[model samples]
Target: MNNKFGLSNEYTLAKVLQIKHYTRTLFSFKTTRPSKFRFKPGEFVMIGLILRGKFIFRAYSICSPTWHNALEFYSIKVPNGPFTSFLQKITTDSSIIIKTKSTGTLILDSLTPGKRLFLLCTGTGIAPFISIISDPETYIKYNEVIVVLTCRFSQELRYFNYKIKQLLKQPHIESHAKNKLRFYLSTTQEPYPYSGRITWLIKSGTLIADLNTYTLNKRDRFMICGSQQMILDVVNLLKSIGYIEGTINNPQDFVYEKAFVN
Candidate 1:
């Protein structure tokens, strides 16, 4: 049923716990999790604010791991954009509404068992992988987890790097993530040793050379999230290499979510 805010009962209110600004355009916020809420690591939930009795919201991939006490999201501030413009002004004293249900194809359950897991993302698409990498179950599911993140600058990568290091310090997760997690960072519009789109890097064999692993193994699994064009490029490349897209009902070798980026 609809509520006074013209929202369904599926939504619940939560106070913002903290907000971290990575750069002028990038930020992340944590909201108190509903005690009864439950979600897998890579899932996303709708979060928004209600104004003038109308709902203004967007689907955001959860950034923090499930083990964390609160729900976290990484977002890009779009000047004058409908939701984010307002979101950027919120403080810890403010509250946001979150949909109780969460869903996404990037969760571990969406792919079949594999020898290795590859998470390829660009920009804010790294949110889901951030959660995936912090989860201990990820280490148990695959022999190794490879993350390829491409950004416009190095500062964005630093946020992700710090998150990983923090997770590595977590008692139950450190041992697992430390042993199995690996990262390859690239910047497109900035000066860096590894600078370029990840898809281009993969196609050019530069990614493989840097990682020292060439060719996709038959037992390798993939989860990609990025710009629509980036997703298309990676999907076509993976398909050419014999990887099959999958769904939760019938797990396959790969999956992708374009929700995070355009």
Candidate 2:
């Protein structure tokens, strides 16, 4: 049953704005904006539908930043996903319910200033990191910004690689990013140019080799967004190395968010 507002009680059909294929079944969408809606760079919102007279919802991070009028989302077409099975078929102008408020703690505002910023993401979890990298303020606050993306294979990195290439070409960030933005893509399950899980890379001391950098120290800020186990592991490693969890008011050495449950 659709809400009386002709949408979900907490969200509304914002309209499918755009769809682009990355790999086999993975696709991304941009939707119509909700005038009353507002969110920070790394926040997330529930997106789904009411089906069989029942409401089904799933949390998805907003790939678009608050500056844009429209909401953007990058989703995986799970084989029989309750929502994506239907969502993937949608095209421009199709309606999609979206919540009014976007919320999450994996934002840059939750971390204290540091000389370097490391954003570690896996699969779709890269969504929020995309927003932070695009924001100009990120460059202003930190001297270095490294985005380490771990995926099952290289094809899955195509979409974001294309996007990062485009962002680096932009005049506003091109020159400024010399000492700021960098992308380090890795694949574990399938063969690719870069291989190995991020955890292994860290343990083997190859992460810095890949980035050609020094060791992680208190002067480094970290944001982990990925699978539950991945988050816990990375968080534990950071803490063991002297980093601390942070918040908006009590910004510290690190921040984290689980991309999704398996």
Candidate 3:
């Protein structure tokens, strides 16, 4: 891909080994890794490929943890989407581009000390939380890690459910997240054990019951990722409950990032 605009910085084409559907169009890919590359969990890198002399680029979160040798990415396959149209056709052994530098503001360091950690996500927004929750640092810093994922169907929940279950089973990590780690799911389109939009769930008190916990407090740190509306709604909820926005320059009670979608 041409980087004439200086938008492309890193060059990588690890072969795709696996792909699976999350929802109708959302999917996840497991790719081969470059041995020399190292990146912080939760950061996003600009990815693109050259096709017919033109390059298409997009930012995707590195969903795998630092400890894993392989790289993982979760994405939405929009019909006729500039990148997704081509990306969805990928299969095992397919090569995809990845930049060298992965950067973002969703890391754990963005928050101050807190006993409760809340990871609020919707759609592909869950990407970063997947990385942070797997990392040992998350459990080491917080007494509890509560992840609330909002999606339209249960299929999209598979990857996250598997990861959370696996992480909870690891003896070394279990102790840190035993009573600490929790997964709260809200399905909007399909009926499951639990169903509704996250905003509705939170407003109607279902979220509290799902979490089996009390309202958010100052000691609780939060991270939100989703669409513009979802982020705004969640932020409003946090504010109504007295949560402050956190940042690297000046730490506060919560952190957030807008998962890019076009």
Candidate 4:
């Protein structure tokens, strides 16, 4: 396959270690990681496979923390997507291609130090936040971590719910999350206790009321990932409240990335 694509040095082949299906359109898989592949928890890298004798790659956020030996990715299975249709069919031991470079704006370093870190996500946008929360440095940097995930269905929230429970059981993470971590799940099209777009929740003051915390302030930093419209809505709301957009070089009060490029 390497010879066929002429990608011997450009990409590394990783063996699929495990895979789990969360829904017809969503799944997660872990793959062997190259020892030299290092990246911040919230970074994203290009990954793909060969199909019809051609290399097909797509940018995907790394869901696993840097401390983990293997790499994990949460993906949406687009029925006709050139890369995902092929990716979703892989099983254990299947080989995949991962580019060596990883980059993104969602890392903790992109935001100024703050008392609370709010991770706002929708759909598979939860991927990068999974990595951020798993890293110990996140706990060290902020006194509080709040994760808000909104999806269209109740079942879509299952993976995050299960993962958070397991993460909270780990000896090191358990202590930090005991008092600092809060997870909120909401659905848009399905019946759930919390329903509606996150922007609405914020505007209605329902979110802060539920958390029993004061409204966002300068001490509260935010990282947002989701659909384009969702990101725009949230960004506008934050800016209206005086939150400044941040970057790797210029640390500010908030940062964001699109879940998938349209």
Order of the predicted models by TM-score, top scorer first: 4, 1, 2, 3
Clashes per model (N, Cα, C within 3 A): 0, 1, 1, 0
Pairwise lDDT winner, candidates 3 and 4: 4
Candidate 3 lDDT by residue in tens digits, 1-262: 3255344345766788889875678788888776587877668877776666666778888888787778888898888887898898887857877777678878777788998888888988998888888887898899888888988888888878877777777777676666667888878889888888777887788878776688756788988888778888888987887888877788888878744522
Per-model CA lDDT versus the true structure: 0.87, 0.81, 0.79, 0.89
Error of 2 at 117 (Å): 0.3
Off by over 4 Å in 1: 1-6, 258-262
TM-score of each: 0.95, 0.91, 0.88, 0.96
Judging by TM-score against the true structure, name the best candidate.
Answer: 4
Candidate with more favorable, higher TM-score: 2 or 4: 4
Q: Rank all candidate structures by their lDDT, best first, as comma-separated numbers.
A: 4, 1, 2, 3
Please, what are the lDDT tens digits per residue for candidate 2 over residues 1-262? 3457466356666777789988877788888887788887888998776577666778888877566787888888989977888878887757767777778888888887789999998888898887787778888899999999999978888878877886787677667677678878999888876788777778788888878889877799988888788888888888877888998899999998743544
Error of 1 at 194 (Å): 0.9
